[model samples]
Target chain A: MLVAGEHVLFHRARGFGRDTHGASPPTVLRHSLVKRKFFRLKLQRERTFAPVRTLYNLNLRQSGKMSEKIVLYYFDGRGKMESIRWLLAAAGVQFEEVLLTKREQYVKLLNDQALMFEQVPLVEMDGLQLVQSKAIMNYIAEKYKLSGKDLKERAMIDMYTEGLNDLMEMRMILPFKKPDEKQAHIGVIQGKATSRYFPVYEKALNNSQYLVGNQFSRADVHLMEATLMLEELFPTILSTFPNLKAFQGKMRSLPTISKFLQPGSQRKPQPDDVYVKTVMEVLNIQIP
Target chain B: MLVAGEHVLFHRARGFGRDTHGASPPTVLRHSLVKRKFFRLKLQRERTFAPVRTLYNLNLRQSGKMSEKIVLYYFDGRGKMESIRWLLAAAGVQFEEVLLTKREQYVKLLNDQALMFEQVPLVEMDGLQLVQSKAIMNYIAEKYKLSGKDLKERAMIDMYTEGLNDLMEMRMILPFKKPDEKQAHIGVIQGKATSRYFPVYEKALNNSQYLVGNQFSRADVHLMEATLMLEELFPTILSTFPNLKAFQGKMRSLPTISKFLQPGSQRKPQPDDVYVKTVMEVLNIQIP
Candidate 1:
């Protein structure tokens, strides 16, 4: 696939490979043949005038394959953007993370008329600035075939993903909450809500190794991120649900996921609590 | 198509048509021929084990076609189920609504191990009991080709739908807010958040008649629902955006949408406040 004058190849089991041939690129093969054998090579070559144009061209490269440039813009926190980061890693999609922390940059991004929502975890991919985390996640899932085995499976995955989102929403606290209130809030989330939700997950995991199906899907990935989050915020929360604990262990042990989570690996940890930092360190996500 | 002993024909423009020819059913033609010209008739002949089996066997139905049986389970309220109801109505898919109001039924459903999440808004169709409003909506969208023209268009639709969902989440009231603080809370949401977010939508509407594309897609349907909710909650909110107002009028004016919104139509308004009641009445949605 020729993208931005660069020859890129996407291997199924392996990550992206680049075969830069400068101006005189190698003769591209029919994308159909490549797709049948290797991966779904998406090539974006159009220079459209629209602010967002996510067009991809699929040809071939003689050597290895490379993906289009993906830059993830987010704050220096593992809040809403962590799942997206994890999704990129799980999909083996090569991306550069731009951790924006400065107040000036926030003001600039907010004032920027081009940005639809002026929000982050904004994914700049294939010349389109994609907003909304779930949208980005769904896009990656489709592109990588991480959605599900079938339509019903995909819908079930969506259900589980939305459930995880709801669980996260239940844990939120007001910014004006006093230190004591914060403790009480966490207690409420961990004791009541988490206790109620985790068992359902435990029951599901007991039935199948994964959340949706036999294979690891985007739902499992999302569940993993949310689970880690809960664990970080309230340690020993998952200890009661043995199946959920097992599920977490199984998910983290995946080669791609483990590699991303590994302390020495490339995934740099954003601003989080002590527990999250510890989890990151154990998982090999660098604590910045 | 042969569903049970009855031959059902599903017409595109018109709803289902039933030609129940007792034991000696009419000569069944191959489904492919019916699909090419007359209608996209889905036939399920399998006498499967499931309690609900959505099956259709097509023969010569003289008048308009008929579809398989669909059961929609939700509360009497329109909270999350209204969009699903709208989609079903728009698709012209014949469905039976099982609105559960009793706490005993709720407990029974919760205990029913068949339910994945033990949640309402469960759609029993095609031998599968589907849950989650968005998931069900997507399923119906795909079934009716309301998703989009293609994959990219579908992704765009997903983006806009998620965008609308984000807006809804932003409008939610924090549980901990005091009675006095609630007014201030609404003020911040309406003032700072709505001001910052709504212009992007206005701009998008100005660019196109619908949210995703020229044609009315699922995204437009979702956006319409959310826009109405906002309008109901905060009267005169859309006065600033003429394009959006026009878009709402245009969407509400659509045949299927207008039919769904009509007061005398089959749709009965779910439990909501006086504000929502007024908006529904103006939109021709019955305030039941």
Candidate 2:
């Protein structure tokens, strides 16, 4: 038998208990036979019900519940969640932003018993839970149709997203290390970004205004966040790439993003701030 | 416009291409229209004409085309390609092994004008070029119906594949640096695997003989390759994970795989042995 919000499958010779129905067969064998018949019928019903059960349940729950349909559990700082939140906003979807304190509260969340990746931003949508920031962003882009409109666009978006992810992973080592080591690492990355990555981005953006195409996409949103981080965190480092700077400016000018950058809007900590503090101490830059 | 053995899709004139065929498009787009159209048609045609194209184009063009319909461009010893080759063989798929020369040839390939990522184990499936070993392995697994039967099972397979990839990226750093540094890095990874990864794997196995369901899938192939690499490349590192070792041994015992490992059937290097030799020496490992 198929329930309203669930598919109930009964195995062969197994049926709903007879006690609840107030019906009993004349004898044990007769009862068993009746149960077997019901079991077969219920199995048939389940086979028909299996495909649409979950979809139906989700629809029902979404329609009935006034609670937030999507909740993104993350820290307020940009680090990982910036691109995802941007993507969700771009999609025009309504979602709850559950912010956590960066240092202690965030670590506690990672240690939570039910958390999958020991990280954030974790996105819960319609009951499905997704970890991995990139995966979550992609899922939201997918659900809301904010990803590119064609196959090539999606692949290109994927390529750029993966590339940015690689860059982010490399950049992450900067903040959690010693001063000298951090400077050396940043120098290597800055050199590479100028000579290697910037060229790729420049060429990618040359014929088209955006990274993938003329219209903006999740890839653009991701690039926007990454470029914003780079500009605020390592301004002088990537100054050699004029095209990249211009691209960053163009992204920031978008009305959707410009509002977010208004004066007094919260700004995330950039590695550059940390670098500056350490370097000033090393080189004796006075505090005025 | 749909073709057999092909997941063909045509974007309608709806500005955003709507797939008229039954192909499932990914949720995001990030490519220009020109590139998007090219890949869509190419992927569609490749599926339909792969066998024919391989016989005439790739196989006839290369000397060893007669050996295997699937040619995996790899190195002499173990690296990223091992898992891919293992997956193909485990799936009972016949493939030609094209080993490149290590120092001169491998470096040349990396510096190839057309190459992306400067790496190998590029799988030539029926003449279509597939880079990224994980993507290639996935293509093969999906085509052969060896990934998983259901959505949940497929997601689990993806989880394991992604986890192994994360570990592999860390392990790759070992060959590019000093021995002490390499050992320290290996120690960190080993600790994490013991404390984090191994437990996850153990729970997934949970007394089951296979990773996904009753039958062997690409997850098993990946597990086999990862375990073998850990044991052979970083001996004593995986000794603590007895269950993982047992699982590898169990995978090796499969008839399809066991046949490949039988005496004299092992493949060799073409001209890339020198680079492999240098890398091995740098890592302080003797070639068997």
Candidate 3:
């Protein structure tokens, strides 16, 4: 199970091989070479013995029933689940995806069984539920060996990932309200961006091509997500920071991210997209 | 040196045997005990580690300082530095408290040092600067063994501490403004208190005595400072929440706290006692 904010996702076994009607149960099956490598990566990153053992025990409980694999419970567009989804997809890991569409359905599921958050984007591995977007993203990244190899580089990844998260929370999440109020809020955010945040990122980018290390890591993924949102969501504010714009361009040009840019892969804009639209309108910029 | 937001503090060494200034060069510190413990607690709760050793090593630099102890830099009033101060006091640790009185001074310091935030409540220990209040608090708590003895209890401490910090940021920090906007903002904060935050605390308090364990951990200190502020700063909103009132009373009645309440401890009301005055005026209640 995984919980972030008010969202919770859980995985339980139906039987051995079949997908259960109520809750999906764990399965024991042979993994692909990539999956095997992912599992080794997870083991290597986990330092504590207790929780690792607990996860192992959970897998053992369903060992004889079916094949072993990972499962995810998530909401489509809330919190930090999107990055986790991207990480899993990038790593080529196949897992069950359960999307909770309605709030009522979400609450009912919570009442029937234990849910981490009252909301989605939770990953249930073995029996344990993980919450918090950073935690989930880092976990999946570790499991996939997507984080940088060395210790210092890894710290940089954590730092940049966290920095991106903080930036999004301040820039996008909190200010994402009605149109007029959002505009006012964005003005404040823009001021800070010009004065504080953008300069920091500009300095960071000047120091290295990537936020953290030589190769792309979860930090890059998070930055890509934030910058991509700005491309659609807050274009006007985004225009002030040309370096940030270039950074976004660089990230989207990456092979893996470039694949995601195919026409069909783009998600339809939500009602909240108006905020982004307004930002662009204010900035007089067009979305790509 | 540690930086959280706009605050910075430094821990510097005096001569051996005699405590005096200008004896040695100061080192900068990043992330406090509270922040580290919070991160660790999040990692533990998630049962995931992405380069755990990297985080551990980043944290380890705080331990090797030779001469200095902890020094806090922040604004006056129990804003960000309260928890760190309380943690040090609880652990019987020594620290220097430096208050940044003006915004210009803060910006000057930041420009001079390239500090992360031109803010307050930063701690410096053994020449390193640590930022983020939760990080600082947890670091001190861990070093002194004040957080918790067991893992589960420690996690609970983190949960409550994080919640309280969220509350403080929402209540105390965001709404505060120049005197001209104070009245209107007070009403907004009052509405939020009555409509949102109060109920959450009431529900949480119904189940747990302390935020986490039986012992008075840093969570309690954080809760105490926040609740105390609400009582003083936004009394009108607090009036509806009797359980919260009783909780504040319970905390204030503790022997250690009672001593601080006596005449000379600086608990007396001052012009800057926005938290205290607001709560008192709104709730029409007095602390014994």
Candidate 4:
């Protein structure tokens, strides 16, 4: 049984069945059950009359349970979850993409009492609903052995990936900038940040073929995603750093990675590019 | 020898001596050397004529070199590095605090070539000049065996700590809020976040004495720091959560932690805080 009262309610409400053993639930399940329960209570209290539903139904029919079935929840466009998607592909793991492309669906999920931090790039696996992109990615990375060879390597990967994620967050703010301010902000990024930060990546790549361990790592995946985003905005961005360019090329050519980069699967063009859509839809504001 | 050009310059500039083996420097040493070197180059490039100095001088006189000595560079205030300081205290490790209280000294370190991300809470240990508080904390946690008993425990600790850290980040923005907006923001936090987040902690504490593995952890330390900060601002904040209050009391009762809480070693009041003084002094701006 879970310690939190609301979690107990959530598990019962979600119809979360017994754990894999059917005798004793895992500790993670207790954590998840409580979190979802707590969130559900908050939702019910805040919007008493509104019909709010959990994002995903508790599917207890899978043979392997949480271990076998991986569900990723994110907006329709490939934004924060793209690298995660790439990681799944690279790891050769099959997953269910529960892309909440519609405004209504997003609102519903936002109101869902199960969302920790009330944000996405949430992942459901192994009987737990893990929130926070970094935490989710780390879980996947650890499970798939993509973290690194040793603890030190893992820490290095975490460090590099953290830096890359920070850069991604900076980019996420671009679409929200006013038209007048957008150009100037972009100028600083393209002119100054690209030169300052990219060379750092280029230098890292020069030392090892990959970012962290000379082996493919979550850091490389994160860096590759950043490179794709930046290059999409400014095509000639990577031209100055040959090592990074080559590194980008190498990452893009990975058979698993290449599949995701195909025109059909590639990220949609901006404007409604996830974050912008999130703000516009969430705020009910018309982005000009 | 380190691979990066600037790092080589940095190590030489910092007067870093070769490790005991004297063949190739350790990985952490190389990492520190490169970070310092890279930051130094950036400082030099940006402020060509400015007098840029390193954050801390090379102290290789210690018998064990980097392995033995630990240096934490931050403003005297218990800001981002507070949790780290607590961790070191809890670990009972001796560390040197190079508090950048002087404006010229702080500015010099800020403009130092080795300060990556150009931010503080920089740590020097194990021959690595680690930037980013989170990274440094994780490193220390791992090194000190305070992370968790195993990977699963570590992940759980990470998940809980991540939630706590997110909350901490939210509180960090409180100081900048205008008076008019402050109350509304505090209302949301006290009413919504406290009700939602605190119960989880309460439940966790109810289940076990510690946040993770029923043993002392970095997560508990971080939570303690957050609790202290929150209680400092809103004295009656934890009155509703008896379990958390008890947990805080238990944590405070720890001898090492108690020592840190003692008034003499306590952080001084802000505005004329260390980092602010550094900036005002460095820029020669008159503080009202």
Give native contacts recovered, as a fraction, per prediction.
Answer: 0.20, 0.00, 0.00, 0.09
* lDDT tens per residue, model 3, B1-288: 111232221111100100001111111112222233443344421211221111122234445533354556554445556666666764556565544443333333343342443334456674545554544565577666666666545544654565455445434433223344456434544543454345656665675666556766776766677677666675555577667767777877776665555675423232355543442222122222
- For candidate 4, the docking band is incorrect
Once all C-alphas are superposed, what RMSD does model 2 give against the true structure? 19.5
Per-residue CA lDDT of model 2 for B142-203, tens digit only, reads 77777678655665566566556545444443443234344644564564455445566767
Task: Supply candidate 1's per-residue lDDT for A18.
Answer: 20
B-chain TM-scores per prediction: 0.64, 0.64, 0.58, 0.70
Best-to-worst TM-score order: 4, 1, 2, 3
Q: Of the candidates shown, which would achieve the greatest lDDT relative to the real structure?
A: 4
What's the TM-score of each model vs. the native? 0.65, 0.58, 0.53, 0.74
Candidate 2 lDDT over A1-288, as tens digits, reads 100000111111111110111011112213333454453344321111211221112234345552346765544445456566667665555566554422223323333322343334566674555665544665576666655776545555665665464455445434433443456445544543454345567667776778876678777777666666666557675566667777778877777677666664333455455443442232122232
**Local distance difference test scores for all models:** 0.52, 0.48, 0.45, 0.56
Docking class of 3: incorrect
Order candidates by lDDT, high to low. Answer: 4, 1, 2, 3
User: Residue by residue across B25-100, what tens digits does model 1's lDDT show?
Assistant: 1112122123323322222233421233222211111123333457765544454466777778877666776554
Any runs in candidate 1 off by more than 4 Å, and if so which?
A1-67, A169-177, A192-194, A233-242, A266-288, B1-68, B169-194, B233-235, B265-288
Query: What lDDT score goes with residue A236 in model 4?
Result: 88
* Predicted structure 4, TM vs. truth: 0.74
What does the lDDT come to for candidate 3? 0.45
Q: Residues A169-229, candidate 4: write the lDDT tens digits.
A: 4455455445555575465446433534575688788767888776898888888888878
Per-residue lDDT of candidate 3, residues A1-288 (tens digit) = 111222111111100000101111111111112244444444422222211222232234345433255555444343446567666655656555444333333333333222332223446653444444544565577667766875445544654554455445444333223343446445544444455455656666775677766777777677677676555555675666667777778877777676665675423233245443432232222222
